[model samples]
Target: MSIERIISRQYEIANGISNDIGLPKFKKYAMCNLRGGIGKTTLAFNLSYLTNDLLAVDTCPQGNLSYFFDNQYYSSQAPTVRDLILPYLVPGLGKATRVASYVGATNEYFADKNVYYIPSTEELYLLPSQLITAINQALGLQGAQKEQSLKSILYSLKEEIDREMEQNQLERCLIDTSPFFAGATQLAWYAADALVIPVRTDQQSVKSLELLINTLTSPQSEFRKYLPTNDLKVPQIQMVVLTHCGWSTVSGARNEPNQQTKVYLKKVFDILSRHRTLLSTGDPSNHLFMLDDFLGSGRISSVESKPLSLLHSGETKVIDRVRVSVNKSVDKCKHQLQYINQQLWG
Candidate 1:
């Protein structure tokens, strides 16, 4: 008969009606901060791995997150983020039959969970130009239609996700984007139901937080101007996470954060605390939280190199001392990540 009838028939065969198929609460989060060196990739990597049934989308041109999971797997002619996203801009590239085709599962990083990630490549750098044109064209559209352009393009994929979630396929979508708040970053923000901004305890981070807060609060900001009005509320569903707080002490005792870090931390806490209040009272959108995850100088996971989280030493020479240092550093980093998550969704 009709398409609607076909869908109804399929639902009947599945032993359930549309009403019985209660989809899980899907959460799309974008982890971003304008400042570089803030361990955004590292936080993204660990969080993605730790989260259950997650689809991690990497929008960074650096491809650091892709590298973490054996870049070869993601880079082996598989559909990259650019391939999937640009189709929306160009049109007529043939619909993505299986959206999961663009994703790659973790080889063996986590024993219990299989985290799928949308890989990025160096060629994604060319996206800025195409993205600008698409955004401009979207802006040119009239009335509410223009506002929905961004979100509408991703609607099919989101529907597929909802269907999968209804079938217990995946539970979450985590978006990891580049440092700049433009192009792909804007798309991630538009798609996210919530945001997790990872910040470092540094002067630049303080400034970045200020800028982020001001931009999201002000309707006149350029970032705010381009956001799809359909399902976008930047400030209400956002959380701030502090990373890389220095705790090193030469006296063989754990030390507090440096004075500069402490000062900036206080400033950030004050800013986010106010936003948290606004999000609670005015918006009442999900939950807003601030977390502290201390990461020292441990080597972060990358395609070319692995994490030092499992460092060992067979030699009895200086390697023994090196192992101790690496082990201690990794422990602190892992603890920080766990603490951040505990505060974020707990």
Candidate 2:
């Protein structure tokens, strides 16, 4: 079947589901994909503008998202996500700290917006091994019980974040997950109400999507296998963003995705069709959004730690000793983000 036809059919299915059962309102969104360099962090940072009172969580050990929000976090002795999860890892330590105590406001760029973030630390790299050791040493818990205990430890952060949100009146929580589905990323899945997966226009990303879906749905997969025995729930796939899509010029005007992009998009749509139950039901238009490859604009925004909405066209910045100019791309990028935000929360 043609890609367009498949998308139409999927849309019909989604619309029917929406009409029958109603859509879920998601307050916590996890930006995730099994592949890296697909603009997951960028989407998380930009989407913070979706709400005025926002709490962004950096679950990646690399701390890229944390740095973007506040570079000083790396140099200073600030509390991080590591601090929040440390108590659970060490038995002698006191209970987990309040999430609000660890959260810090964003830098000057986001000063106008009430944005707070749980910074990341390089020490999070050691979490997986430490978590496993902690889980195995728990007394009287075996097999599924042990797994449930591990899940509870990982999920504790989410519970605290929920309380923090209630106490502080935060409107939304956005979790920036690591590419690997281990440690903190697992915690992100447990915490999120929904997921926004960003896929690059490439074969590797397609395979990564398949792997991610398997981890979420396949009966024999690591995470899914535990679901039947435990009360664990995986977040639904709320949106699949096709990032870095290329546009070709036709008769001196650029419109629609390029041929290569279309081909991969078909592959993606095909994968999603087989797992319709995993998708969130709502307006079909909200299920997918194509984002252009605004390479220069993206670099500038990341380097400056600003959202596309705050960036202007025709701006030039020196990146790596090269003067890169931002053309009209920023406008389109900003518009796409706004549309996505509206679909998600408007």
Candidate 3:
């Protein structure tokens, strides 16, 4: 499909979804992509601001999403996502824990908007082995029993978060994951109702999409191999957002994805076409969206822990003792994000 047609279909779907007065179909979404540098963290941070009652969860040990909400937060901080998992690591220590105990309020910028998040710590890097040891020692059993036990521990966190959302009256939850498909990333997938996978306009990013599909859908793949039954449901692909797309002016007035972007986009569509069963819509165009490259504005937003919607053109800020201007690109980025939010939950 052409980029213009895809945008039109997305807008049409967004309008229909936004007009509905009922609740959204999916309350939990995971921002997932096996490849890094595709703007997953940035999108998750910005989408959290689309509504006041949304909760953002940082499941990656790298903690980039947590840093975007609170730059001052350190790896040493208490009550991180690690705290939520520690209790379940030991068999007897497991108990009904409140998700609110680990959640922290966002920085001042997001605080007034009533946004909250569960932070992550680097210590989470040690969890996979620790979890494996705990599971092995608990029972001398091997194979499927071990896999089910591990998933039970990981999934308990999601159950607690659901209860917290209900008690606090939150509207939705967005989870940011690590690029690797193991550990916390697995937890995010097991917890999500749907997934928003971001792909950059590159051959490697396109390949990552196929890898993700295989891992989730192929019975021989690691994740699906253990859980062969539909009892542990795999999240459906809600959308595949093309990030950092190159754009060029067309007809002297409108801008559209440049030729290079179109080439890769065709490849993406070809791949998605073969896996229609994994998608939320039969028409791939309805599930595709693009965000033009806005590196200058994105850098400032990341450093300042602010969303593009709050940024303005002609704004200036000092970075490393040098003054930098926030140009009109900020507005373009904000418009793209707003449209995406409408398609997602409006």
Task: State TM-scores per candidate.
Answer: 0.73, 0.87, 0.87
Question: For candidate 1, lDDT tens digit of each residue in 186-279?
Answer: 6676566666777777778878877777766677775566654646555344456656555335464333454555565566666655666434
Prediction-by-prediction clash tally: 0, 0, 1
lDDT of 3 by residue, 231-258 (tens): 5778888888888887666665344567
Global Cα lDDT for candidate 2: 0.74
Show model 3 residue runs off by greater than 4 Å.
1-4, 7-24, 94-106, 134-151, 250-253
> How would you encode candidate 2's per-residue C-alpha lDDT over 1-346 as one tens digit per residue?
3455423333333222222223456889889998899999989888885466888899898888888877676896777777777787786776544444222354676766777777788898988887667656653478777776666676766876786677777888888989998778877888888899999999999999999999987788655554444577778988888888876667653346678888877778778777777888733334666777878888888888877778788899999999987768676677677656655555
| Residue pairs in collision within model 1 | none
Candidate 1 global CA lDDT score: 0.57
Clash pairs, model 2 backbone: none
For model 1, the superposed segments whose C-alpha errors exceed 4 Å read: 1-26, 73-75, 99-106, 144-168, 226-231, 235-238, 248-255, 277-297, 300-325
Residue 80 lDDT in candidate 2 = 76
